[model samples]
Target: MKSYLAAAVQMTSKPDLEENLATASDLVELAVRRGAAFVTLPENFSFLGQETEKVKQASEIAHKSEKFLKTMAQRYQITIVGGGFPIPVGDGKVSNTALMIGKNGEELARYEKVHLFDVNLPDGNTYQESETVKAGVSLPPISISPELGKIGLSVCYDVRFPELYRQLSKQGAEVLLIPAAFTAYTGKDHWQVLLKARAIENTAYVIAPAQTGNHYARRTSHGHAMIIDPWGLILSDAGEDPGLALAEINPSRLEQVRRQMPVLNHRVFG
Candidate 1:
């Protein structure tokens, strides 16, 4: 039970909810066919619209609210990380949330993004997630399976924070799930490097599913969905396409790396 198959679903989602879900379903089935026990979708796997207000309008509540996610999870019969969705929170603000679903379609955990992407890139591309998306207060990781080990969940922008991954690794997470919809401006420069850094420093496996290519008007995303081992080796990469990347995760590798490096035990912040 030391080895398990995992996958990341890359997509360029559109503004339509039904169309997005249909595409996601097809991708999940493809992952399953490729023998992935756990599959994760990219951020905004549900919808990537032209306007921020459109996202708010499409937001749905989590509890007994979003039928699309649950239906897909059960239908797939695999642990589906439903990427990040817009959930209505009261007062015109919504949470940029990620949902973890079990094989039986039960909700395992939900992590609302803490660090919102609020930057003005050099290409005159600017994003203000805080304009419509509200930040989450709690930080909780989800356990995929006993064999796969506990997985900490984080959205696109949260990858820039090392402290969060450190905390997750310290709390017994062997894998970190990063579902992103990164802009081409930033992803090309920092995506792979940052992902490898997190895996190396934290001594944990990192699976990142990304939105690639252009979606909607004047919006482009960098897509290179990948799965990296604990030793900073990239096992599989989707390479700028709408597809899946599969990797066999070895839990014992985490222990082996931790034993050799022992960095987690040597940390002391003054």
Candidate 2:
């Protein structure tokens, strides 16, 4: 694996599919112009709204989101991760999926988000993702690229589960992609800490894109889109806005961190 720049794109995506796609296009251009070889869009980059609205438009959302990722990848000649869109499964259910596209617009890896966010917060915010999303039954997949190293994929809530990332690391993943739409309620106290812990424990680079600002009624995201090095250092942070967090993803640094603190190697159990 070689040294390259990766971007974590933060956006305030609403229910409008076309508008969100346009925004993503501009962000992708920004990343490409800044010399990023790999760029990631946050979960719900295509659409973020009521679950029923999302479900109602799942087919259209999936189609356009996939096309946009492919088109952007081919046009900019950069690898991209477009994620957590609603892909209609059956019986009014959709799989929250992420697709990694290569420079040539070829699909490299696809991961359906396994963990669902189902919680009731004291701040009067309640999320029951399982109501519409079908949980992935298997572990996430890793894409071993010649230029990008081993890239593992996961979505928003999956970051809360260390075992998910542990499985990725155990499968030889060197970089972890955790794109999210983290709520303001939890993100303030938990987002960066969780991200750092994942990087530190896995000994891998973590690229996390996020959704920031208000998307709809009473639904606001806590945004600090960031990239963390294998040593758990905050390389770049895009704080509370519609922008990007850019950083260097270096294999040498990953190797160095692993040499100094081989946490994965020292793991006691599954």
Candidate 3:
């Protein structure tokens, strides 16, 4: 009966940093009240307006928005995923980063998004993430103790690449975090399928928090923030709204699935 409760927070973030943080903080507080020991926010939870605005926010986020995350984690006495935000990395470019904060308000780990989104959609929208965001080089899976299990950190576009999840599973990842701002067109078509695939294939729990609704006139996200178990079962979903999805992470259930399937052990190709 021992289980860890986790929450995924969905949001429709605006261009205003203060407004976004306030909204996110309220959601996290709700999750904590619902018995969540680990809480996750969505991508661009601090700001989502124009590309230029993201670049500007990157330079100021460490002292401003990120500080808010640390304080919230401490106040709630819970671990938190700071979603994904842009951080300036010199050369006039930034890296889309996800941060983990401990219950004691200590910065645990940082994951910079490796796969940049450079695509043209059928909806006539295109994004060139590399134009302003630098890609990360490492692929190490981050782990924590009793609060959170071995965690694989990834951002929005990285969900398409199975190789990253495979590497993470190989490195002992029991929980996968995918914080995304997926376009409405693509997410409606592929989001659930991809999430279930990762969980079933890796035999790991998948926690995906997302940005929903229209941010500006042009950017609209498909938000079905969900938590999936090892057998590809959806535990909880926050459907197309700014809210929270709660689920229990049972370590024994994960072990049972792995024992039955053993997909990770049967892998032949890298």
Best by TM-score: 2
TM-scores, all models, native as reference = 0.94, 0.99, 0.97
Q: What C-alpha lDDT do the candidate models reach, one value each?
A: 0.84, 0.95, 0.89
> Candidate 3, residues 97-199: lDDT per residue as tens digits?
8998888989888888899999999999998999988999988457667557788889988999999999999888899999999999999889999999999
lDDT of 2 at 89: 99
Which of 1 and 2 is the better model by lDDT? 2
The 10-residue segment of model 1 with minimum total lDDT is 57-66
Cα lDDT for residue 185, model 1?
90
Name the lDDT value of residue 17 in candidate 2. Answer: 93
- Please state the error at residue 13 of candidate 1 in Å: 0.5
Candidate 2 TM-score versus the reference: 0.99
Tens digits of per-residue lDDT for model 2, 15-121: 89999999999999999999999999999999999999999999999999999999999999999999679999999999999999999999999999888999999
Q: After superposition, how far is residue 236 of candidate 1 from its true place, in Å?
A: 0.8
Each candidate's number of clashing pairs is 0, 0, 0
What are the RMSD figures for all models against the true structure? 1.9, 0.7, 1.3
